[model samples]
Target: MKLTIYFDGQFYAGLVEIETSDCYYAYRHLFGKEPKNEEVLYFVNHELLGLIENKSGSATRSSEVKQRPINPKRLQRLAAKESQKTSLSTKAELALKQSYEEKKKKKQMNKREFMEQQKTHKRQLKIMKRKAKHKGR
Candidate 1:
């Protein structure tokens, strides 16, 4: 597979071979180092960029590939796909946010409970010390 990556508005076209660990990392290696986040969306073919923004999949290059006018029907389909992705991402973000808040709240509650127990133990120890002193009298 080949992809064109955008780095700060500049385009670099290269081949992306698959690996066992990570697909993105395989492509990043071609850049001589790890690629930055912004470079992930670069398209190997400039024309595909327009189609992809409205759609989720990549355009495959074939030997018989011909240059022709883009179909309006395809564009419509792509737009629909984009809308679906937006909704999915929004839901995922909300779920993650709620999970983080719950974790934080639980941690705070545990800490408060621990501190209260410590205070109670200290008070009990103080009372025991006073009783011993009174017994000596």
Candidate 2:
């Protein structure tokens, strides 16, 4: 298979025909040295950029990654996706806030409220403490 070699996705040194993906022949041909365990084809620094098709066989660039041109389509898609995600999160927070307000309104009890709720709260705390002790927590 033909692979376009790159250095940090920037320094493009054209393409070369290789017998296989991770073979010694390709590594030696591109890097001009035998491949190491760490600096293999798919590893850091030494990377097999991409495959060159017989029809569209052109991979030419030597600039750094930051200097490369951005695809407009990809940027537009990302912007739209981010906007949708932000909108959904905002809606969820609004719904949560509305529920919280409703609950707060319902819980606005008078001074002469039921003593049963206070009793039940004390009972629940006691039960929680007892369960914790029983479980050796």
Candidate 3:
């Protein structure tokens, strides 16, 4: 959703449904400050412009308030940066945890199997050392 601030003497009128809004700077007198992003100045008509101030209070004045849809990719990126923050999403986190557990399960071996693997590894190292020692001669 895009927002625009209205300017006076531009030969435009207010919207029943705002086709566009602008930054006329005249509404600051009513708002007592300059408008910020996502803020709006609506024309009651071409002659009268008023600022739509967002109240900090919890109660919404209108149910028609607009909101953008949540972006899954954006949430994933944020989740990657701060895992502990929760990102209000669990898909990536749970997927990572499941994969970690599965990997650990695959790598585990019985004590005897581990010992046999170590013995084979040592034998291979011994053969390599013997070959290297002979190469100099």
Candidate 4:
């Protein structure tokens, strides 16, 4: 399960298996961007090193691809600012979208439950009416 990855003229140690498949997928999905299998392996290896070994140095491809220094703090702040520059209703819009999805799911569940209850009620009623008819005969 261990793999050796090459980065910055060095090979870093990495693990293939994790407690969850999501971890594997997330690592692959992040670095799989048109990368060769070898590159993906290397990327994951170096990524793990950056994470466990160096917080500031842990950025995966930013170092190899960007060819320039990218401050993580500055990038995060820029992203937040861009999101805020949208209309004042952006938060409301996001909330409404989430609620709409929840409403749809809830409505579907209610419909299914209602139908099930109706079927059970009809079955019970039929059983009672049959019993009454048989007793009167």
Estimated TM-score for each candidate: 0.34, 0.19, 0.21, 0.34
lDDT of 1 by residue, 26-92 (tens): 2332343446554544433453444434533433344334458879999899999988884333568
* Better-scoring candidate (TM-score), 1 or 3: 1
What ranking of all candidate models by TM-score puts the best one first? 1, 4, 3, 2
Cα RMSD, each candidate: 15.0, 19.6, 17.0, 18.6
Task: Give Cα-based local distance difference scores for all models.
Answer: 0.58, 0.53, 0.49, 0.57
Error of 1 at 129 (Å): 0.7
lDDT comparing candidate 4 with the true structure: 0.57
What is the lDDT, from 0 to 100, of the residue 71 in candidate 2? 98
What shift in Å separates residue 83 of candidate 3 from its native position after superposition?
57
Q: What is the lDDT of residue 99 in candidate 4?
A: 96
- What digit string (tens of lDDT, one per residue) describes model 4 on residues 40-78? 666666666555333332233323333367799999999
Order of candidate numbers by lDDT, starting with the best: 1, 4, 2, 3
Please provide, for model 3 over 1-137, each residue's C-alpha lDDT reduced to its tens digit, 9 standing for 90 to 100: 22334433332222222212332221222222444432333323232322334322123323345558879999889888887665423478888888998877767756668999999999999999999999995
Query: Candidate 1 or 3, higher lDDT?
Result: 1
| Candidate 3: residue 39 lDDT (0-100) | 33
